[model samples]
Target: MKVFEPVVRLMNRLKYAQKFIVIAVVFVLVIASVSFILMQRMNSEITEMEQRYEGASYNTALKDVLQQVQIHRGTSVQAWNGSEDAQSKLASIREQANRALHVLNEQHTKQTYPLHIDEELDAINEQWQAIAEKDRWQDRDELTTLHTNLTTFIIETMLTVSNESSLQLARSPASQNLIATLTKTMPSVTENAGNLRWLGASVLAKEGDMTAQERAHISEKFYLMIEEFATIDADLQRAFTDPDIQAAVQSTYEEATAANELYATMVEQLLNGETANLTSAAFFEAATNTINLQFDLYSTSLAHLTTLMEQQLSELKMNRIMLVLLETLIVLVAMYLFMGFYIGIKRSITTIEQAAISIAEGDLTTSIHLHTKDEMLEIEHAFNKMTTGLQSLVKEIGESSQYVTASSEELHVGVEETTKSIMHVAEMMSDVSEGANEQTARLQQSEDALQHMTNDVAQIVTNSEDVAQLALTTMTLAHDGNDVMQQSSTQMNTIQQSVETTQHMIEALHGRSEQITHILQLITGVAEQTNLLSLNASIEAARAGEYGKGFAVVANEVGKLAAEARNAAHEVGTLVQGIQKDTTTSVQLMGDVTTQVRTGMDLSTTTAQKFEQIVSSMEQLSEQINGIIVNSSQVASSTEQVVTAIDAMKVISTKNMAASTEVATATEQQNASMEEMAASATELATMSETLQTLIQRFKV
Candidate 1:
C-alpha cells in the first residue's frame, strides 16, 4: 500500500489526454475480462451437456441391446422343449441379438464412458460368449444363475448411467430426487415382473418331479415374487408425477398383481396336494402372457420419461448458444465504442499539433478553431489573447516611431535657424563696436585743441551727425535682430511642442512594451502548461505498455512543440524588454529635448529684450546728436557729453555682443542635442520596425 501511494497520486494528477487513455484502457480490459469469463462458463456448460447427452444415449442403446439378448436367451430355452418352430426362431433371435451386440460395441467404441461401465460391458460380453458355446442343458441351473447375473449387471449399469444423466439435467434438488426415484422404480418393476415369469415357469415345468421340500421352496419363491411386485406397485404410486407415466405404471402394476394372484393360487394348490383339478399348462400360459403385458407397459413409461429428458437437454443447449451470442455482441459493441473514443482523441491531438506548427511558422493570422470544449479550447483562448496583445503593441510602436522621427526632424531644423540668427546678431554688434571706437578718437582730438575747437566743432557736429546716422543704422539692425529673435522664439516654441508630443508618444510606447511583456508572460505560462500536459500524457502512454508506443511518440512530439513555444515566448519577452528599455530611453531623451527647447525659447526672448534696449539707447543718442548739431557753440561741452554717450553706447554694444555670443553657444549646444535626439529617434524608429516585423510572425 505504501509503495502504491505515489502511483495513485500520479494517476490523480494525470492530464486530460492521460486520463482519457486510462479510462478507455480500463473499460476495455474490464469488458474483455468479463467476456472471457462468460465464454469459459459457456464452454463448461456445453461440455457438461454433451456428456449428459452422450451418456444417456449410450445407456438407452445398451439397455435395448441387452433386452434383445435376454429375449434371445429365452427363445433358446423354449427351443429345448422341442416346439416345431422354436429351433428356427431361436436361430433368428440369436442373429438379432448378435446384431444388437455388434451395434452396441460399435457405439461403445465411439463414445467415452466411466471405467466401471466398461468393465461391466466386458463382463456381459464374456457371459454371452460362454452361453453361446454351450450345447446342452446339463448345467441349466448354472446357466440360469449366469443369465440372472448378466441381466442384473446390465440393468444396474443402465440404472447407474440413467441416474448420472438425470443429475446432470436436474436444475433443483426436488427434480433430482424425482428423477432418482423414477430411475430406481421403473427398472426394478421390469426386473421383478420378469422374475415372476421365471418363477412360475419353473414351477409348472418341474411340478411332477418335485418333492415336498421342493414344492414348499417353490411356494416360498412365489410368495417372495408377490411381495416384490407389491413393493414395486407401491413405489410407482409414490414417485411418478406425470399423468401419462402414472397411468402406464398403474396398468402395469394391475397386470403384475393379477398374474401374481393367479400364480399364488396355483402354488397354494400345489402345496395343499390339490393339483388334481388344476390345468397347469393353460394357467402357466395365461400367467406368462399377463407378465409380458406388464413388462410392455412399464417399458413404454420409461421410454416416455427418456424422451422428456432428451428434449430438456436440447433446449438447454440452445439457451447456452443464445447466451454466448449475446456476450459476443456485447464485446463487439464495447470494442466499437472504444475505437470511437480513441479516434476522437487522436484527431483532436492532431489538430492541436497542426495549430502549433502554424504558430511556429510565424503566421500570426492563423486562427485556431476548435469545437471541442476540453483542454484544447482553453489553450486556443490563451493563444488568441497573446496574439491580440502582440498585434496591438506592434501597431502602437509603429505609430510612435513615425511620430518620434517627425518630431526629431522638426527640432533639428529649429536649432539650425536659431544658431544662424545668433551668429548674425554677433556680426552686427562687432560693427557697432568699431564705429564707437572711431567716435571716441574724434572726441579726444577736439579736447586737444580748445582754441581750434570752434573750427573742429563744425567737424565734430558733422562727425556727430555721421555718428547719429551710424546709430540709426545700428538701431535698424537691432530691430532686425529683435525680429530674428522673435522668429527664433517662435521656432523654439514649435520645437518644445514637438518635444512634448514626442515625449507623450514615447511614454505610450513604453506602456505598450509593458503590455507586450505581460502578454509574453501569459504565453509562457500557457506553454509551460502545455508542456506539463504533454509530459503527463507521455507518462500515461508509457504505463499503457505496448499499445501506447505510438501514443508515446505523439506525446513526445507534443512536448517538444510545447518546449519550442515556451522558447519562442521567452524570446518574445526578451524583445519586449529591449523595446521597453528603448522606449524608456526615448522618453528620457524627449524630456531632455523638451527642456533644451524651453531654454532656447528663454534665451531668444532675452536676446529680443536686449535688442529693444539697444534700440532705445540708439534713439536717445540720435536725439543728443541733433542737439549738438543745432547748437555748435556748446560743441566742446557737448563733445565730452557726446563722448560719454558714445562710451555708454560702446558698453551697451559690448553687452549685446556678449549676449549674442551666449545665444550662439546655447544654439550650438541645442543643435548638437537635437542631432543626438534625431539619432536616438532614428534608432527608436528602427527598433519599432524590428518589433513590428517580429509581431507579423503571429496570426491573430
Candidate 2:
C-alpha cells in the first residue's frame, strides 16, 4: 500500500533544485490557467453590461432632447401678437428640433439599428426649419398650412424615428408604468400647443389695415375660428383624462384652446370698435412660458426614467464586483491550505517514514533526520533507544565466559583425584591387616606356656586357679587388640570409598560447569563483537565532528568495556589454573589412598571370615561411615559448582551493565540528532509560512 506519507516524503527529499522548479512550474501553470479563464469570463460580462448601460443612457438623453424640441416648437406656433419676433421664435424652434433629430440619429446608430428612421427625422426637421425661415404671414392660408405641416413633422418624425409603436410592445412592466405617468401630465402640454397654433392662425387672417366695416367682418370671422379653438381646448382637457390618449392629446388640445381664446377676445374687441392694442412680444412671451411648462413635465418624466436606469446599473455593477471578489477569496483560501498547510503535513509524514524504515532494519542509528520537531522526531528518538538496548545486551553476554570454563576444569581434576584416593585407601587396609596377622602370630607363641599352666592348675586347686586367671587375662588382652586392628583397617577402607564417591560427584559437577563455561564463552564473544560495532559507530560519530561528540564518548566507553572483559577473562583463567592445581594435588593424594585401601580391604576380607562377629560389627560401622563420606563429597561438589556459577553470573552481570551503559549512550546521541533535526524542520516550516505570506501579496 503506497500511502501518501511515504510518497510525500520521497517527493520532498527529492533534490531541492528539481522540487522548487516543479513547484514553480506547477504554480505558474495553475495560476495562468485560472487567471486566463476568469479574465475571459469577466471581459465578456463587462462587455454585455456596458452595452446595456450605454443603451439606457443614450435612450434617456434622446428623450430629453426630443421633449425640449417639442416644447420650443409649440411655443413658436402659439405667438398671437402680430409682431415680427414670431419669425425669430420659429427659427429657434427649428434649431432645437434639429438638435433633437441629431440626438435620435446617434441613439439609433449606437443601438446598431438601420439609419432609416434617423434620416427621415432629419429631413422633417430640415423642412420645419425651411418653413420657419420664410416670412410670409400675409398669406394666411399659407401660414396655416405651414403650422399644419410642422405638426405633421413632429408627429410623423417622432413616431417613425423613436418607433413608439414598437417601443410600447418592447416595454417591460417598469417601462409601462413610466408610460402611464403621461396620463396625468401630457394634457396640459397638448392644450398649450393647440392654443398657440389657433392664436397664430387667427393673427394671420386678421393681418393688414382695413376700414371699420371690413375690419369688423374679418375680425368676427377670426373670432369665430378662435372660439372653435377654445372649444378644442375643452375637448383636449377631456382627452387628457381619456383612457387611450391621456395627457399627450389633452395638452395639445389645451394649448390650441388657450391660444384660440386669446385670439377670439382680441378679434371681438377690435370688431366692437374697442382698440385693444396687443403686441407680438407679449403674446410670444406668454406662449413661450406655457410651452416651457409643458416641456418641464416631459423633462421631469425623463429625469425619473434616467434615475431608475442609473440606479439599476449602479446596483448591478456593485453586486457583480462583490460576488467576484468573494468567490476569488474563497478559492484563494482553499488553494493556500492545499499548497501550504496540507503540503507541509505531507512532507513531515514522508520524512518520518524514511526514518522508520531505516530503524526497522537493525539500524538503531536510524534517525528521523528531519528538521521538524513534530511527533515524527519523537518516534525516531524512541526507536534509537530500543536499538541501543539490543546492542548492549549482546555485548554483555560475551564478557563472562572464561570463569565458567576454568571452574569446569577444576571440578574435573578434583573428581579424578578423589576416585584414585578411594582405591589407595582400600589397598592400605590390606597392609594393616597383614601387620595385625603378624602381631597375632607372635602373641600365639607367647601364650602357649600360659595355656599349659592353665591345664595343670585345672587339677591342682587354689595355686593353679591363680595361674589360670593370669592366662585368661593375657588371652582377653590379645583378642581385644586383634579386634582394634580389624576396626582400624575397615575404617581406612571406608574413608577411601568415600573419597571415590566424592570424585564421581566432582566429575558430574565438572560436566555441568563445562556446559556453563561454554555458554559464558559464547556470551563473552558476543559482547566483544558488540563492543567493536559500537567502536565503529563511535568513529563514524566522531567523524561527524561537533555533532557527534556525545556518540564518540559512548564509543570510548564501549571500548573500555571490551578491555575490561579481556582483563576479566585473564583473571578467570588464573583462577581456573589454581583450581586445576588444587584438584590435581587432591586427585594424586586420593589415588594413593585408594590403592592402599584396596590392598587393606583384600587382607581384611581373608581375616574377616576367621573373626565373623567382629568383622560383621566392623562392616556395619564401615557402611555407616561410607554413607557419611559420600554425603560430604556431594556437599563439596555442590559448593564448588555454586561458586563457579556465581563467578560466571557476576561476569555476565558486569558485562550487561556495560552494555546497558552503551545503549544509554547511543540513545542519547540519537536523541541529540533527532532534536537538531526537529529544530531545523521547525525553522523550515516557519520560513515556509513567511514565504506563503509573501507570495499572497501578488494580486492573483
Candidate 3:
C-alpha cells in the first residue's frame, strides 16, 4: 500500500488533459475488447452454422440419391414383368435416377464434405454401382435383402440429417418451423408408399386362388393410401417453392394419381366378376413401379429442397460474418486514429498546463515548449509570450521599486530638514510673541505714569493761581510729558516693527503649509494609483479563478495595504487641511495685528504731537506770566483743559497697550500653528519612509 501511494499521488496530480487522455484510451480499449469478443462469438456461430449446413447438405444429397436408386430398381422390376409400354416407362425412370445421381454428385463435388461422411457416400456409391451392374435379380429374398440394406442406409442418413437440422433449428426458429412442417408430412407419405407396395404384391398373386374378401381388403387399403397420398401431395405443392423441387413434387403427384386410377380400374373389374384383359403380373408391376417412382420422387425432392435451404443458410452466415469482421476492422482503425489524435492533444495541453502552473507559482523563467502546428501550439506560443511579458513587468517593477525607495528616502530627509526648519521658525515666533507681550506691559506702565502725572498737574494748577508760580509748575510738567511721549513713540515704533516681522513670518508659514498641502495631494495620488493597481490585480485573479486562488489572497492583501495607504494619505490630507486652515487663520490674525500696529503708531504720533503742543503752551504760559494776575479766571480754565488733555493722552496709551497684547496673543497662536505644521510634516516624512520600506519588499 505504501509503495503504491506515490503512484496514486502522481495520478491525482495529473493534469486535466492527461486525465482525459487516460479516460479516452480506456474507453477505446474497452470498445475494442468488446468488439473483439463479439467478433469471436460471431465467428464461433458462423463456424457452427457452417458445420450444420455441411452435415445437412451431405446427408440430404445422399438420401435423395438412395431414394432415386430405389425408384430406378422398382422401375426395372416393373419393366421385366409389364406390358409393351412398360419398357419406355422404365427408361424414363432410369433417366430420372441417373439425372438425380448426377445432381447429387455435382453437389458433393461443389461442397467440401466431411471426411467421414465422404467415405460413407463413396461406399454407398460403390455398392449401388455393383448392384446396378447385375444382369438379373436371382431371387425375391436377395432383392428384399438389397432393399432392406438400402432402406437401412437411407434411414440412418435421414436420422443423421435430422439431428443436424435439429441443432440448426435450435439456433434459428424461422427455418425450424418451415422444416418442421415438411418433416411432419413425410411420415404419412412413407406409410402410404409401403401400403401401395403391399397392394401391388397382393395383386400379383394368382387370380383364381385369391379370395373375394382379400380382394376387397386390398381395394379398401389401396383407396385409403391413395387418399392419404393425394392429401400429402396437395400439401407439398402448396408448401414447396423451389422450381426444381416443386416440379419434382408435381411430377410425383401425377404419377401417383395415374397409378391410383389404374389400380381402381383393376379393383372395379375384380368386383364386377368380369374378365379383366390386363395380366395381373403386368398390372401389378406397372402400378407398384409407378407408386415407388412417385414415392422416391417425393422423398428426393424434399431432400433436395432441404439441401438448398441449408446451402442458403450457410451462405447467409458467411456473408454476416464477413460484414461483422469488416465493421470491426473499420471501428478498430477509427479508434486507433482517434486515440492517436487524443494523445497528441493531451500532450499539447499537458505541456501548456505545466507552463501555466509554473507561471502561477511565479516561475516566469520557465519556458513553454510544445511541438505542434494546431491551436495548442498557438496556445503554447501565447503562454511563452505571456511569461516573457510577466518577467519583463516584474523586472521593471523591481527597478522602479528601487528608484522609488531612493526617491522616498531623499524626500524623507528633505521633509525632516523642513520640519526642523519649521520648528526653529516656530520657536522664533514664540520669542517674538514674548517680546510683544513685554512691550505691551511697558506700554501699560507708561499709561499708569501718565495718569499719575495728569493728577499731579491738576493739583498744581489748582494750587498756583499766581501767574509766575502757575507758569513755572506747568512748564516743568510739560517738559516731563514731552519726555514721556517721546519714550512712548519709541516703544510704539518698536512694537510696529515686531508686528511687521511677525506678519512676514506668518506669510512664510502660510506658503510652507501650501507646499505641504501640495505634497499631501501627491501622496494621495500615489495611494489612488496603488489602489487602482490592486484593483487590477484583483480582476486578473478573478479571471484566473481557482488556479489563482493563492494569487487572489495575495491580491486581497495588496488591496488591504493599498486601502491602508489610502487611509494614511487621507489622514495626511486632513492634517494638511488643518494646517492650511490654521495658516489661513494666522495670516488673518497677522493682518489684524498689522492693522492694530499701524493704529498704535498713529496714536503714538498724535500723543507726541500733543506733548509738543504742551511744551509750546508751557513756553507761552511763562512768557504771559506778567498778565496772569489780570487773567486769573482764564488761567484756572486753562489749567482744567490741560488736565483733560492729560486724561485723554492716558486713554490713548491704554488702547495702544491693549492692541499690543492682542498682537502678542495672535503671535502666540501663530507659533502654536507652526509647531503643529512642523509635527505634521514630520509625520508625513515618517509615512513616506514607511512607504519606501514597504515597496522594498517586492523584488523583481
The top-ranked prediction according to lDDT is 3
- Per-model lDDT: 0.54, 0.45, 0.57
Q: Write down the TM-score of every candidate.
A: 0.54, 0.36, 0.57
Ranking by lDDT: 3, 1, 2
Candidate 2 ranges beyond 4 A from true positions = 1-61, 64-83, 110-287, 300-333, 357-362, 365-700
Error of 2 at 520 (Å): 16
Please write out the lDDT profile of model 3 over residues 524-602, one tens digit for every residue.
5655665665566566556555555654565565556546655655665565566556656666765766676566667
lDDT: worst 10-residue window of model 3: 170-179
Residue 210, model 2: lDDT of: 40
Q: Compare candidates 1 and 2 on lDDT and give the better one.
A: 1
Please give the lDDT score at residue 166 for candidate 3. Answer: 46
Q: Tell how far residue 633 is off in model 3, in angstroms.
A: 12
Error of 1 at 236 (Å): 5.8
Model 1 clash pairs?
A: 362-697, 363-699, 364-698, 364-699, 364-700, 365-699
- The per-prediction tally of clashing pairs is 6, 67, 0
